[model samples]
Target chain A: MLLSGDPPRGRILSAMLATIVAVLAVAPFLFPSTRALAVAERIAILIVLTASYDMLLGYTGIVSFAHTMFFGMGAYGVAIALTRFGAGWGQVVIGALAGMLLAIVVAAIVGLLSLRVRAIFFAMITLAVASFAQILASTMRDWTGGEDGLTFEVPKTLTSAFRLGGGYNGNLVTYYLIFTVAAVLFLFLLRVVNSPMGRVLQAIRENEFRAEALGLRTLWYRTLAGAIAAAAASLAGSLLALQLRYTGPDATLSFSLMVDILLIVVIGGMGTLYGAIVGATIMTMAQYYLQPAMGGLANAFSGVPLMQAVLDPDRWLLWLGLLFIAIVYFFPTGIVGRLRTP
Target chain B: MSEVLLELRGVETRVGRYQILHGVDFAARRGRVTMLLGRNGAGKTTTLRTIMGLWRAGAGSITFAGRRIEALGTPEIARLGIAYVPETMGIFSQLTVRENLLLATGRDGLASDRLDRLFALFPALRERYSVPAGVLSGGQKQMLAIGRAIIEPRSLLVVDEPTKGLAPHVIEVLIEVFRRLKQSETTILLVEQNFRMAVSVGDDVAVMDDGRIVHAGSMADLAADEALQHRLLGLSLAVHQ
Candidate 1:
């Protein structure tokens, strides 16, 4: 922030970054192939989830363990809005925004309750709140569809309305629309991160008392940051529903989801925006491909083939837990931290 | 010869479970340096802090520039032309010299000139504007602190201790800077324990002992009074170490 000697150039760099994203987004439809469309849709989903996590964990210093509550709420909000009302994508977007707004309101009240409590107490409150959210979701089974979850006819016309080589591209149009919104959001967040408001946040992280002494209404500013973080997670909820055509506490929001986000931000570097993307990519790759790939190596080492069976998808949790320990111990600064130091 | 700028009437302060200042009555004149001289534990620092509203003033009031400002916050007190250089310097360590200056925003319209004047006063700051302030030497950091605050709308600059552990040359430069600051229409409240250095720059001096103003008079009177110095500071010229 200091060496740049100019603040306006950040916006320009963000614009350039956005242009690259736009170009990468178009490359999937070079042939309109089904194989390419599936990959694109997956990336779109990941972007929304990761971006929301970044806004909360990176920008704000809350380091929450209950953010997925808002994400789940947003999904349910949209699902209910669409299922009962037969509303279009506009209502879903509004529903998501409403979820975000609701999260903001919740965060404000929660922040007040937790303001005086530093570190451990704050983290504990969030954890309890998230568990409560999941329980509440199941209790409202009449509206939320209980444990079985809710399903709806995917709003085909909204996606098809766009001229992505005209009619019925199935998931391709939906992926493109979500991808575009995510891209815009990414740019918008970048603008916010480099603004005057962002600098004050950084200042707060370095020394909150000093920032408070400077006549900054520290409580209000912190609560506002929390609200913004919740809003981002809520948007992620909306995108999750649209992509999967389903909404449930299990899928849209859960304790594990918040844990995954914590892992992502820790891997990415807590304060940087790009760290979220990096962390998500690292985590997703580990889950999607690493475990199976390790099976061949395990066979060579053990010759018993027990490694693959024992280290299947479920055991990844143990590995993730150990990875977190390693992160806190050996790489306390996270991935981006060491690079930014010099 | 300057007009009165600060009047502390029966000011009292309590920090934590202890009352650190008691009925400390003193006044600083505009465009002149007033030193708060005392031994290490004689509440020299607490007096400066109470003036800036760092600690709550339990009783009495402080009138700065003809306004009662005892109840104001630190930033509010600072905004009213009273720049404080805390004993710790309060230098934003992560920020560069330029960024520290940027954060010390004066009145909305008069900030630009103050920035320019500060750069002109300290040429080294201009050279190392982009470097983080944490990297600067003790003297340079002190200079930056003084430079950052000694600008527009600042009539009183409260310096806790500029030469606490500085070498002789650095101490000389700080004194020169303080002398220069005094000439530029800025009243200064200097708190120091080194009697020689304290008495030289300050036009008026107040000696504090255990939370009370034990003596208050012209700098010349306190500097020349050897009997009082020996009684208060346990220093005798004949048995000087």
Candidate 2:
């Protein structure tokens, strides 16, 4: 039982978590770099997305490839509202709510369609649905802006690089906003997983037939988890659109983005909530800094053709592939899970 | 004897293309331990599954508390006050024993008095209450599974092979536990391969073979007649005794 797990260890974990949050809050002042803040914001948004995904894959034991579909819905929700409705901050809230509702409906439909099948078939169904959604986004040029995507202005206060008085200005406000949202969403997810309902989710994950024998309506619980996860993912999607002031299929709905989420979950530890945040930080930092750093190494090894090719910035995926291999080989339980084991 | 708590009349079940239960008729009277005994592939498990609505009955009917439940889902059947301990001992291995028991109960969770009673019956579970069930020994895991079933009071309890692969001492403990539970008000339908334990615990007996009940009678009748046991079970009860 979560209530009975090592109390001292739990205390240490909470302390560690508090330290991490404090450091993140003061990071902007400590670094004072725009590029750093941008990277941190990106990680913040992804933390919400991946944590939501964990609710399905980790807690509920449902491997879904259509997570990006909900994320895209959130982004497009805000994008469409601003571009066509000439929406303000109030409309932003309306867009998020609409996106969440849409996500619940779509997730329920998809879950009903695919839940009849087993794991691999469910994954395939979600993939097919995600691809179809991507195509729909591309073809519906009228609403989605098609392949070119949509760029729109947010409220002047949010977009202004520098405001004179107490109004928010520059990267600091956006970064803090992103951080606050991510933190709140992460805590919400944590609360859900710790609750008695969450315990049922884990029980279903471990053995659905058994859970049912205990009188749990497993399908309904799993469906509820899907709706909750989808809603949170859409929230992240909306934040991403706000952060970039742009929306596109490739950016939001791509299967590659889902794969990135999978990588973050696996590398950080699939079921652990905070692992998502830790993973987002590690992976985003790698993406931002790995290529250029590897480029410098590539030049150093230019004399050796093979070494230079392997170290090339364009081939940074090779290094990432190796990193993935190393993580799986050494830490199969995941970083956070491994920390908890001892 | 009390009225029939569960009655399966002419029940037939098909899993995919193959039919597993063929018009099987069975009943568990109130406050009695009805043992369904058979060799492997005898459809004993299927009969229990049909009663639980894990497999839909293609024909005939299963009546629980005077209501037809042949068309209900597994959860619906479970909600009708039946607790099942599957053959695999269906403990959530990743969860702690206490969590497994907690999930068995809903919002209020296990009452302290009820928990203390269960702990007294199986003290090993109390010691390993916080440990993940996967780490618990096999006997302890079996205890946890049975503990989960009794976490909430139910009208009927169904168990499949509760003592399978257990040590003699552990089996002895379980046999006593079942005896004590039989003293309680709940009706029990048990599927078991070990005839010794069956003879000890069961009040009524049904011998199944190839998806049908070949013989049904009082456990006293079955136990007293070694010739009948030899003819049906391919081993005399005297030999094991």
Candidate 3:
């Protein structure tokens, strides 16, 4: 498959992706309103977040649920840095690194304890650890601002060119900043996934026993992969705090983030990077369009109770739930996997 | 007289507290094909697993090239110049045949020359070099597995059942590959239950019963001693017209 060129399928996909990204990148300049740019910005962040998780779930086959701890930490780190210390872009990046460090430490403890267990047990352990982090964040009311949350000033230096930090600019600057950061991380993920390390990881996922027998350090590789995922999540978290200009227990350590990321990975595909983008786009758009779309459908199907439930704009989540179930049930490989591989 | 490259002294292994290998003493020497013969559940593969450090040696010492390797992990063991071709073939099925070979052939001497020789030995592999090994024939897969082991700077090539489920022609092809490996002065340890083929390429053989070696001697010696062989192998060596 790697060397095959039976058709122009790859070129077609690449062109399609390039066109979509071009439209996304250029839309803010042409649009009268910045809402579409905001959507793109949020979608780009979700792509990084989901792609990071897919590294383990899709490629490495080490499902982790506690990486949200890193994301939350990253969000809190940059939020606190920008609000308290009046930090700049460099400081925000440093704060993001701190979030990554926090993630690494947590992953180490988790990795050490759970390295021996495979599959579901690993997933449960990571989930438990993440929950613990969330609970701790909520308990620290003074630092995290609990459910109500804390306001943060956008870093004056990062907002310098657009004059956004002084509270004067539009969403365009923020979206571009988020887009650039997410793009860097996305490219980084691409590089890492295609590297030698990635090959070993994919090999480990395929057959761990053979990997161990071949002399690869299975535990270390797994831990490293987990750490990379954590780092990626932290970056997304930092961006989340940046975009909102705030952090709270509700926003920083939300379970919704985890659920949405899961949906993104599942809907897109597990093993491939492009799946993150596919998954994220559908997930982000569901919230934006599902309500309006469902409202229109509900008016058309008044007599049907189940269709009412499915099309209730207030219960758009039900539609999402159905789609998710359908995807997992019908296509075990995922959307990208189903479309791409023979 | 052949040089003994490896020696196992009462090697025992356990998987989740259930003992698989209970004190197996075995040896494979230089420039000779040592065949480990046993029934399916007789711990033949387990013995190979322990020797390669896939499973930890609960009790025993395995010395490879005069160095104690029982404590080492499999990768460390492989780095010590021992290559294992497992029963599952250990072919990275998702990767192309060439990628699989490259990963296994890590820094081994005369690599290009060895690769050329291996490709020559298995032309089917060369033809399907870019294809995933998952699609290859069982015999071709077996040949690829052996060829992978041979491409390395091999001190010992421990193969777990190279002839498992191959056609007569495929087995014949594998035997030729094994013969070529022998000519390269590489020591080969084969795990086999196929009586005829096992006896053919094998210089020495160990009959394993219930995780222990019941008999170990030169193949010719066992071929001549019908009564002793029948007692250990539970098979008659005599040909019937």
Candidate 4:
């Protein structure tokens, strides 16, 4: 067979994935906390975004810095449609399509512009593009709500945080919606990576010139990967806008948001699809919980001045930076890569 | 054997302001091994790359199977049934040997009969089909690279420095394989520094220097005339052996 013949291992991994999905589907009822449900939904959205980044960085061997711009497009698309046109399901769908279309067009343009440049130069160009996008978002306040962002009313049926029936609450409904969309997109990407085409992407990642010599249209494939990734990241941004009911330049188009994605991919290990999910969940949860937990512990041990300084939630990023360095030092392959290593 | 399969007519190529190939004329005859021998920095590799369309020809033309391919992209040139194995062997170290071969064949993949033939040619590859190509020994990696290139039928096979860093036994094995390949319809254009190995398999030979072809003739003629070889290559083929 052309494939390496790892059917048994594939089967076991799929089974494990099914079980994880099953648990996540019922997690709202099991956890019974609105905040917990919120965090889980956020994780789901971030997972989709992070996984999309992996398509470029991991599979296609491209490093892009404009990922969050597309994500911001998604958020803006949904928010602008909801607030200006009204909350009809049809309008939301159109807005999502608009956002995704923008992402694809931008990605294609960027792909074309950077095609002839070296890898590091391409990254710099994307960084410049992302900066330009953020500036545009902030300045074009008429449509995007500028610095304050757009906040719109949702359809009451979806805002059911208090509705009671069939174990479905507003939080649960929102969670399930985000979770389902994320799951479908994630699975689609998984299938894409496992196919024959995925093999070509991986080949390009390993050696672009060799792949080219072997008769592969490396540029077309790289462009395709970038477009797909941008679309998915946009969708994730739309979900984030819905979840927060806010679409601001800071939340969507900021450099920090892009760095967050980079960190998630790096921590999860690039190339492995599941690593994106694992890394998103771990990073999101750490940001959500670790800072406060450390802050509380530091307060309890206030006698030690250094403990308070290092453990302050305001200084949480410093701790995360140190953690990132440690991960790079000890687990260079990342969490999934390290775990898989013999 | 006299029929020209791939022809380069006054092809010029530049890489970042440096002209690597200076108006070169080269050809590979059908069903024959054409050895391209050159010293370091003689633009032998550049000649192969220009044919493959990896480096765009600044001027002139390349014709494969009677169609101009100099202006085409790399994939289009490859799709015209020309396979290239570079000096690096170009094996994807992370992928298993099977995957590498599959990628070479594109969507159709290797057929049973073709795979069987490949296994016969390189038995070590069959033994480690599922192992990552990175772990293969240097000789085995060369075999894998050649196997990937010949996984499907092609009009011409261009190989650069195939015997570089290879041991004597490995070179002998490659020579035998090439000899068998030459008997088939495929035209072979090989670039090599090893005079002995090149002379063993080559039917037609071309010697290159200073970004241009200095000499072209039958391999037997070049092998027999030590004085001519000494004048052209600075060393005779017999001396290297």
Q: At residue B234, what lDDT does model 4 achieve?
A: 84
lDDT tens per residue, model 2, A40-69? 788889989999998889989999999999
DockQ of 3: 0.53
Write down the DockQ of candidate 4: 0.77
lDDT of 4 by residue, B1-241 (tens): 3789988889899999899888899888888999998889999999999999889999988998899999999988888898999999999998889999999888736799999989988999999898899999999999999999999998889999988999999999998899889877568999988888888889999888988999999999999999988988888876788
Task: Provide per-model DockQ scores.
Answer: 0.30, 0.80, 0.53, 0.77
Residue pairs in steric clash, candidate 2? none
Fnat of each candidate:
0.14, 0.84, 0.45, 0.80
TM-score of chain B of each: 0.91, 0.97, 0.94, 0.97
- Alpha carbon deviation, residue A250, candidate 3 (Å): 3.2
lDDT of each: 0.71, 0.87, 0.79, 0.86
The segments of candidate 3 whose C-alpha lies over 4 angstroms from its true place after superposition are A1-16, A30-32, A157-170, A298-310, B105-111, B238-241
Candidates, ranked, DockQ: 2, 4, 3, 1
lDDT by residue (A1-342, candidate 1, tens digit) is: 331222222444345434545644784556366544544554555555665666555665666777788778778878887887775766776777777788889988887788558857888998899888889888888888988888875576544444545544546666666777666665556666555566556656666554544444556766776776677667767777887778988886777677777777777667666555456656765666565555556656575567656655556667766766876677576665544443
Model 2 residue runs over 4 Å out of place are A1-20, A162-170, A298-310
Docking class of 4: medium
Tell me the lDDT of model 1 at B55.
82
> What does the lDDT read for residue A206 in candidate 4?
91
Better of 2 and 4 by TM-score: 2
DockQ value of candidate 2? 0.80
Lowest summed lDDT across 10 adjacent residues in model 2 chain B is found at B232-241
Docking class of 3: medium
Place model 2 in a CAPRI quality band. Answer: high
TM-score of each: 0.82, 0.95, 0.91, 0.93
The CA lDDT at A266 in model 3 is: 84
